[model samples]
Target: MGEERECCHHRTKERSEKEYKDMINRLSRIEGQVRGIKGMVEKNAYCPDILIQVAAVTAALNSFNRVLLANHIKTCVTEDIREGREETVDELLATLQKLMK
Candidate 1:
């Protein structure tokens, strides 16, 4: 994927900093949430409470993905369009669909 873009592109920098940082931050929070969930389980906490935390983690991951996907569309897909590589549009669409599932 990195090979697809030149070294000095704004999209590359934006993606590297903005989207990746957001994802890493969210994943770190989710990791902490998972640890709490494990502690809850170890302490014999209520099942529903543990389930709620699990749902929270899932939602966090989904939110992270949504942000990443939006950035990908605005940057990578837009670049592909500008470069007249229509095939990348299909690839991006397919990837988004897979991520949604």
Candidate 2:
């Protein structure tokens, strides 16, 4: 009943400490990988080797996205839906579409 009311401001997520730490660790690793690639370039490493490192970074980012998406679906989306916010589902779909692209 009260769910039908309009929201004047955007919602925010409150992540658990574990989730936050996990994401931070993942990003730190990715950052390290990027720095390593830069070092390789500085030393004139083989193109193929540098490409492999870049691929590894890509995989790490994808893994991060998967974890984040799962958390979003479980927490934010679930709560929004329970509160009668069907629009959140559409927003989720759009975000997924962008991620896939």
1-101 per-residue lDDT for model 1 (tens digits): 45645222343444456546767888899899999999999999999999999999999888877876777777777877887878877887798788867
> Backbone clashes in each candidate structure, one number apiece?
0, 0
Q: What is the lDDT of candidate 2?
A: 0.85
If scored against the real structure, what TM-score would every candidate get? Answer: 0.76, 0.88
The total number of steric clashes, by the backbone 3 Å criterion, in model 1 comes to: 0
Error of 2 at 36 (Å): 0.4
> Could you give candidate 2's per-residue lDDT for residues 1-101 as a string of tens digits?
45442332176555667877999999999999999999999999999999999999999999999988887887778878888988989999999999988
What TM-score should be assigned to candidate 1? 0.76
RMSD of each: 4.7, 5.1
lDDT of each structure?
0.76, 0.85
